[model samples]
Target chain A: MSPLLEVNELQIAFGGVKAVNGLTFSADAGEIVSVIGPNGAGKTSAFNCITGFYKPVSGSITLDGKDITGKRPAVIAATGVTRTFQNLRLFPDLTVLDNVRGGMHLYGGQNFVDALFHTPRYRKSERFYTEEAHRWLDFVGYQGGRGIPVRNLAYGQQRQVEMARAMARKAKLVLLDEPGAGLNHSEKQDLLELCRKIRDLGAAVVLIEHDMGVVMEVSERVVVMNFGKEIADGTPDAVKKNPAVIEAYLGKADEPVKADEPAKAEGPDITEGDS
Target chain B: MSDNVDTTRAPRRIGKPASRISRLFESRQLGWAAFAIAVLFPFVLASNYAMSIGTTAVIFILLASGLNIVVGYCGLLDLGYIAFMAVGAYTSGIIAKAWELPILFTIPAVVIMCILAGLIIGGPTLRLRSDYLAIVTLGFGEIIRLTANNLAITGGPSGIYGIPGVDLFGLDLSGPVPFYYFCVAVVALMVLGSARLGKSRLGRAWRFVREDEDAAEAMGIHTYKVKLAAYIFGAIWGGIGGVLFAAHLSAISPQSFVFLQSALVLMAVVLGGMGNTRGVVVGAVVISLLPEFLRDMGNLRYVIFGVVLVAVMVLRPQGFWPSRAYEPEKLDEARKGKRDGGPRPGAPVTTAKGGTP
Candidate 1:
């Protein structure tokens, strides 16, 4: 099967600091893959480059075998890629239903003339959107009030709404950034199931997670990064046994070194996920 | 086999039925209520002065509703929105005077001018978000006014005069009674259009842009183009309001497009409820007619009006009738049931790991 997404030698930088350096990975159709590392592991930077939020300094990103490098975020999104932010960005003041409907904007059911003139196409599209919005909310397992502002919901529920919004985009690849943050233990479990269910819909799922347990349990494949580079890539079991991956997490290799061994610092070993 | 599938989907079903009151308000029922009230308005006061006051109030509603699209729905701080109205007023005034055409016939020209003006102003300023955009719009408003004052076509400071009244089906709609009804009909149509647009897809895009521009873009909404759409719509709305204003006075002058006029329209939008059509209409009516009620106060009228406005702003910053968000019923009940009811089916099962995959 063709890879749903591919990134080769992706490079992103903020001034002199390399956020993502020479990273490469691919998510095949129907796979749940994860990029795990310590804080600032350049996971999100890579995701941004893939989703067109940040133009990569060098490298190529392809979706469904089609090159999509350096496109606008919306253009890339239209090519079947949707993502959630590290921080929930729900429309706080809009109704919950309206929030989900926002994701369907690209569907273009009616034009201004249709709306202003109350044409049949406008009515049909409006009805379709209303019905589809409810279906998406249900698919996300959101059992909250549909008419109230999203701001009134709890954080966990709000996260679900954000997920529903992204799901409504009906993309082929979904990127979730730290979805587990702030979610209660039970809610985290729900998120895991949600990820699986999302994958069952045949879209490739790529996530950035700090929780090793989630990485091992949910992802079919795991890519471990250290200092802006991929240090390990394989099945979860293989990545777990990789020595470089262990050192990236434990901060010390198994070998004993002399006290005077040349002190060396890696490029971007920033570790500090939002605990 | 279908039975099991239906059963599983049944539990996941979500229903959204708006409350009876909301449905009634959103439908033609509210329009009928307003119509009844409008029909009775002249009866409440038979004087020509009262009729004219009512006419002004209706026109102000049109203006406020237009501004609300730019500032309230799209969250664009358009300080120069009145410039569109100025364009419309001047365009119609010039056309009606020079060509001896009815003011109503000048509408197409007014719309074209307002749209072009919207494009010119919205194109550059929309690139800057929030505060800087506000400053640019403030300058834009002044630019339109100064241009009107300097341009020979606009009759300079003296403006234009002898603009003919609206002619409909060979009937002279020149009298106060006919003119008042005519203004009411136009305002009504504009209000309906504004409300309908607010519920459309573009309106959702506007709200999305307002809430979060980056996320909106991620949803395939072109934030720049959407913002421009809001600007152009607002300009069209204001332009129509201007046509009415010109026809009502049968003349136009640069003095009418002053900053004070812009401020008053903005005040109406804010005071009504930025995004609520009902609140905006009420706000415009109150702001326009409140001074008339205080007319007996003579010189103290302006003082009282200013004080009341300030007090309202301080007390109710959201406006007299703030727009209440329409909450989805299923989501509300689901949340309520989560606390009191049993665990929801299809709810994610948690693993030992603290992170959700």
Candidate 2:
């Protein structure tokens, strides 16, 4: 009955700089929530906190009313949470099918013993992995060679494989960090449709995206942030018209010559290479 | 997705179909043929030196296969792998002499001791990255050998002696010809087990960890535990190799488990190609027997062996038989028998280049 993922008063700081300060948000099953912010607004920092990549100094994160703050990343993911990185963080040397099978690790029916001995259960589980891999790739409309190393794929195809890998988790809550970045116009449209399809599959979808067109068209709700704090939260239409949200992205209306000069652009893009 | 976007697909070269020999290498029959040749080798060469070389080569194969699990599959650099072998040999040798039991019965205790050693070393080192792990393991390996060197329980520098030969229900397998067969059978089984593990779900998890640790963890693979598994499996294989070593020599010594020995084992893995069982096996055989074949060159045999290893590595760094493992779409559909083998309408054309396996 309650929201599936909830974050309250989450604060994380790095040395002298506070990356995310007292940020709060929540989402329920079968809903799409988008977080839009300027480059240094701590959207990714918040994501890193929730996914246990970085331990927050204060506040808590919960899934299905269970506290998950400070848990290990693997532990957090095991509780039905899956995400795609802003950059494609795929096993580049592995086949596309093997990359997707990575998500099914926790649910694999056989263990090391079965693997060593090649038991019937091992064969069945492997067949399951392959079939599920194919199914997820098809669902994402991936038409690349599933047997080749993903490094050889085009950048957009690589993103599709990353999506297929994340969706293969079948997690209850899916967080997509800039799923539309580097995508062509048509590919962006496919991603928009995929977001809705993901929501229709009874999972909560939280997206962090900079493409305003995709964000406005696909997101049911949008939360805006600037300088590590939430400035506004509402429907996409309402958030778009919010004066503060506009100021955070552009600058102050009246006298905005050089107030926030540098990061009036995109901020702290850690994934700068390996497209 | 629209098919109009050319940016979504990388143009690929469509190579000719794989050769017949390559297809043979891809099948299990090749493995069986190699095993058959090993089994029939004794018939062709019955000399004591030949049998000795044969058993030692089989043991080397076992050692290389085990190291492949850690270095090849999981990408963990282990510099002190021989320590596991030391633990196994000493555990079994000490137990056999003190308890007056057959060395065969010491298998269980040898496995347990190796596991404990694996945990001790892996617990601290698996937390670190490869460079630190390599140094730590190199240190621990020396620590293990020095401990064996000083311990009264291990007979100090003299090492344990009079290790009983493998006994099987009143049948003694300690004789040269019989023991060769024994080592061959056991090593074959172990090598097969390692290969089986390579293609399993757990095996895939290990490969994932090797390729990208962070991505693996984000996908819910406990990277630490997976790495520990690699360490433990490597230890067990090395330990079993040790037991066989003691049985072969009828004695044990710290000198047998040295850093150079570990390096040679690792070299076999690298030369054969990492993560490929067939390649490792071939590498082990070449590394172990090349010197004997070059015996006519006297001490120059060592120089020739080194040159050959360097040449092979430089020429084919990917290994003699690199892993080319993946099920093709045509093969998959043919196996399924559900769809008419025709290409579906609107399906994008995708090509598979190079080797097929």
Task: Please report, as a residue range, the 10-residue window in candidate 1 chain A with the lowest summed lDDT.
Answer: A266-275
Question: A8-114 in candidate 2: lDDT tens per residue?
Answer: 98999999899999998888888899998887889999988888899999999999898999999999999888999988899987888889999888888998788
lDDT for each residue of candidate 1 in B1-357, tens digit (9 for 90 to 100): 212212332221223234676556555577768867876787788578887888888989999999999988899988877899999999998888888887788999999999999999999999998999989999999999998889898889898888888888688887777888888888898988888888899988988999999999888888889999999999999999899888888888889888888889999999988888888988898899999999999999999999999999999999976767763344324334444343222234433111111
Error of 1 at A40 (Å): 1.4
Could you tell me the TM-score of chain A in candidate 2? 0.93
Instruction: Please report the candidate that would top TM-score against the real structure.
Output: 2
Q: What is candidate 1's lDDT per residue for A1-275, written digit by digit as tens? A: 66889899999989999998999999987789998887788998898888898999999999988899989889998888988999998889887878888888988679988888889999778766765676677677776666778887889889999999898888889999988878887888888898998887788899998766666778999998877889999998888778787677665654563322322233222232222
Fnat of each prediction? 0.53, 0.50
Residue-level lDDT tens digits of model 2 in B240-268: 99999999988888998889999999889
| Global local distance difference test of model 2 | 0.85
TM values, all candidates:
0.88, 0.92
